[model samples]
Target chain A: MNNRQILSAAIGSLLALGLVSNASAAGKKMDMEQCYGVAKTGHNDCSSNKSAHSCAGQATKDRDAEDFVAVPKGTCAKIAGGTLKSA
Target chain B: MEKPANDSLPCIAGIGLRAPHYCEVLEKLPKLGWVEVHNENFFGGGASLRTLLKVREHYPVSLHGVGMGLASTAPLDQAHLSALCRLCDAVQPAAVSEHLCWNSVPDMTINGPMVINDLVINDLLPFPYTQEALSHVARRVDQVQEKIGRRLLVENLSSYLSFTSSEMSEGEFLSELSRHTGCAILFDVNNLYVNARNLGVDAKAFIKALPAEAVAEYHLAGHSIRDGCLVDTHSTQVCAEVWELYEFALQHIGPRPTLIEWDSDIPVLAVLTGEAEKAQQRLEEYHACFK
Candidate 1:
């Protein structure tokens, strides 16, 4: 697949895992996100020992966005409080 | 953006350069040898990249990636590699590295008759250590290095489980990987400690297996016990035992750029500064030995 397809696939996985949100953008511009949520067992972004704010102490309530994922652009706006973290 | 590009990281101690400490670091310009950061955090151009560029203006930065999943069975993620390329082009980091563990895989199951393949992003998970696995990892490392236009440093993992079908230890796997692909070793001491505590891995033996020059960086962190298993939490002071293991690494693997990683329950900047200072002392002693 081409770059856009490759990017979309990666971001799609991140969105599926709920690590990032999905948002639509102008022209098929592929974007990735740094989203928060409990991504994996050993692989959550940073341990969410505290409330969500930054990478440090990113622990959230049960199954929240504790894991940071590279999601497609425009996805995070759909995620409540999920800011677009990356391209 | 106007600061001179740092050629290399000093054989001294550095911190992970988390967001919490960015402002303080940029303002104070404290006495740190260098700084390391998570590559993904600065993937896109924005305030984060701007802040990183400012940080780059002062000290050398090491780009450490947590989500590369180099060993996953699925095809390598090109977008991730592209983002890294862009980041490297912008930051001109002293070192770029990723973990040896596999963090994602293609999901394969069936709805009774059909199969599905979904990319499963995970924390670093265990994989076999066979020649086949080694070949796969080396090929991926080569792809990454070729894309980034530099030698990538692959780190050791702090595993909670073991693969009985594995053909070699993690150290051996890393050593052979380095030898085959010419990638260097990041040599995370705390990871070895966690594995040993949790899986009876021999830390000293692992260090002995490495080629000294291949060890380009060292990671020092703290671990917490979860259900009686050690976790590479990176959330506290560098414990005394981990420090001892680090000393062992320095003695065996020799002095390299070391980083103090504290991710969770991050305390004040002073706390990380103190931890870095401790690591700095160990580094100094290692250098003094040659003097």
Candidate 2:
């Protein structure tokens, strides 16, 4: 078999053995909520408006715009002073 | 607060798991006594947490925090503590630890009602070793332990400066902190060596002054010297001087779960395992002599 045929056969074997799942399942559905103003300083997960450090554990100040932390869905609305929309 | 008699980490050498080698470690499933990762890195769900969970299946995991800021003068970050507790519930790690340093300060209020700055240094910074600071840190430790529902290992900091207004040595402060709050110490030998070279801290005295029973783990790592100051860079291999210090620690404090930490310019897995094997050898020598 050529490279493409060999790849297909391997994937077919995995599927037959129940070792692989569909694309949606493989994507690991987003069950998280982005809660803003709750991230601790230097612990934010991603980009923020105040400073564009653009990575985890790099937030210079606390509660900046778009410095959201991934929380359980629907949990963000419950935290006092926590907002879904960043200020 | 009553302290646990011992941590659950194996009394063998382990390596600090970093990002570069995650794939290789998972694929190979090498013989590591345990693995530690920074707590903040795996706080939220996604590829990072998923990858860690997969790695967790093979090795006992230790959650070490760098962002808790236990000694911050600002009010304790409740959100951070809650996230940590959630992680502990999920990971069920062998031990959890943080540094004895501060990273936050109260927001600055300018002339009158105008708020100016929200100061939060991302790095671990040292504070004066005074009675007041001790009381402050003790309360915070108690709070963290209470929230986490387990003992927290507080590590000594590698500082570049010392406070002349300080009332005690860092060792005494840690001893008193453990005594008062029942928290354990994560004794970093290289940190002590660095502080000694940088600011004239007495390394042996610091080791001897610690309550040995309260020491639950040992950290061995490499440092770099810049402009006549030894910086705890954790970028290179464990040096001969640090190994001597580790042996000294073994003789004085007895064997504990030791770790070889290389955070920057990380080498291959074999290199880290080689460093860990070096530590394991010394640990075994101590065990053999005692037995």
Candidate 3:
């Protein structure tokens, strides 16, 4: 198979394996080929962001905008407090 | 007494050989009396162990352990002890030592580089030196000696807090433990200095109380200041004050295999060699006085 066909098959296997739990699992689903194309474009756009935080924030915003999931505020602060301490 | 094969630990000074300078040291083969490395870092058979063996060919090696937790309430880690025994057989280290403090508890928790915390976060947790704790540590020390087939040296630890329940001072505890188990002491002069400043422990008295025959080695390292307390950080150059305290220890304790240790933000080989040179100078000065 060509590269595009191989990529499509890998994405199909992941989705079939129920690995993409963060995304919507209901309603009529997009085929693997379509999902792969969308992901590739989204990744290119995210990489252009100035900082990792901006990229992650934009990704979360996009996911929420698409009704993928709810993004909570100040989650980073809570995680930082729980993890950072002296050894 | 007949020295062990490959035994060359000078009654002078040496450096804690770290990964950053292993290649350069092997190539140059600097005029060092001996070198020490953390035993855990070389437990696995890999490049690190390979390099240490190469370095071992040139200088006497001392395996200083930081994770044995001899006083831990938990059952002794048989795997850790086994790894140490295997490394000893392979390296034939001139000496092997562990700290006097406890790092593991009944819950199998640990502290320090493997685990970090502000208080009781599993890393080298200090406890009250009660009679029960002393017996626990003595039993563990006995097990280690039996397993390793050699007398183990235990070093004193630096602490941020003191226990209200401690029945005796740390020096007294160490002396008693040595008396009971026949373990040698790896006296770290910088740790004594830190304890003296932070907890108001009298360093001179502690030094005087120690059984001189039980001392097998000496360690000198730098520490950092934190909120009016001295922390045994071992990052920077050996401070002037610690050097002076080391001189006092040399005078009292007599000549031992002194090691210069710098763990964090390690500098160039020249910098560590320079530090080792300073320790060598001090050891020589003490010898001169005896003459």
Candidate 4:
């Protein structure tokens, strides 16, 4: 089947499953969408936070506090490349 | 009215629609109250956006975000925000949500997806719970809500370590944030369980602290243990302990849209449906009380 046919079948089957009715499916706001890195510690959002689950402990070498780029909202704005809106 | 109109999703359970099971789920159309997906995956539409539109024809899709860290120290990535807004316009999602953690740091730059910004960390990094941080987060959340033209539900983060400079607990911070920004809470049960185990946070107190009416959705996920601390790994099945905590949350906050979140090492469609079914059973028990 073509794309429209495939989508039609999918929506039809979804209705058949009683998961979503045609009325509600059409009516609903019909919405809606990882990593970790250096400067990243045990957490990434993965196994920890990035490594939180998926890449747990990928970067275990603890960096000193100075390695982190995080500053207060004020200082962050003053940094050369830290404009709120990028060029 | 018979029952006060509750705009939240049905009390039944749903699953996180991951890349692995997309074809199967779309083909089979398994029984689920709703389905959620990461917002970044569909940033610039192509086949992925096309598929999501078709999926939208079926299930109630929730736009759950991982990259839009509300507490990030960097300036709000308007490009990223615009991409999210475009996706929401196309999808008209049932609920739009993001993690309370901060991921945007200017240590690196993202080169793709129309993000005209310097480097942003790919991970969900933790932040201190100072008053300053809370104000920053509330303002950022307000920006997102205004852009989306809808209330954004903020999910609590699961961290391995605690910051020494933190002035308040994560739960209290979230409570105050809701009061300030009118943002709803996503209430990830697994994150709370992981934090309780790793950082000695009071799980019961965390649940008690949240504004119940502010909670828009509930997430149940599996985790793994490393060294001594529990990791919020969404790899395995939802553990028994988290199920108990979820039920406890239901008792306290009442039922809302519940989702089973299995991210990495995603299992087959059947496995996710099975987990969703288990949650559905608990929801039935919760719904009986309103009868």
Best by lDDT: 2
* Cα lDDT tens digits for candidate 1, B1-291: 011223377888888877666666766789888998888877777556766777888898998887788898888888989999999999999988888877665666677856667566556677888999999999999899888878888988878788889999888898899889888889888888888888898878888888887788888888777667777777778888988988888888777878888887778888888898988888888774221
Off by over 4 Å in 1: A1-87, B1-7, B288-291
Clashes of 1: 18
Candidate 2 DockQ category? incorrect
Q: Candidate 1 docking: what grade?
A: incorrect
Docking class of 4: incorrect
Query: Could you tell which candidate, 1 or 2, scores higher by DockQ?
Result: 1
Go through the candidates in order and give each one's C-alpha lDDT. Answer: 0.76, 0.81, 0.75, 0.78
- What's the distance in Å from true for residue B145, model 2? 0.4
Per-prediction TM-score: 0.76, 0.77, 0.71, 0.73
Global CA lDDT of candidate 2, please? 0.81
Fraction of real interface contacts that model 3 preserves? 0.00
User: Model 3 in CAPRI terms: which quality?
Assistant: incorrect
Which regions of candidate 4 fall more than 4 Å away from where they truly are?
A: A1-87, B1-8, B107-117, B288-291
lDDT of model 1, residue B200:
92
Ten-residue segment with the worst summed lDDT in candidate 3 chain A?
A52-61
Candidate 3 lDDT, B29-88, residue by residue in tens: 888889988887777674456666777888999998877888876678899899999999
Please state the error at residue B278 of candidate 4 in Å: 0.7
Name the TM-score of candidate 1. Answer: 0.76
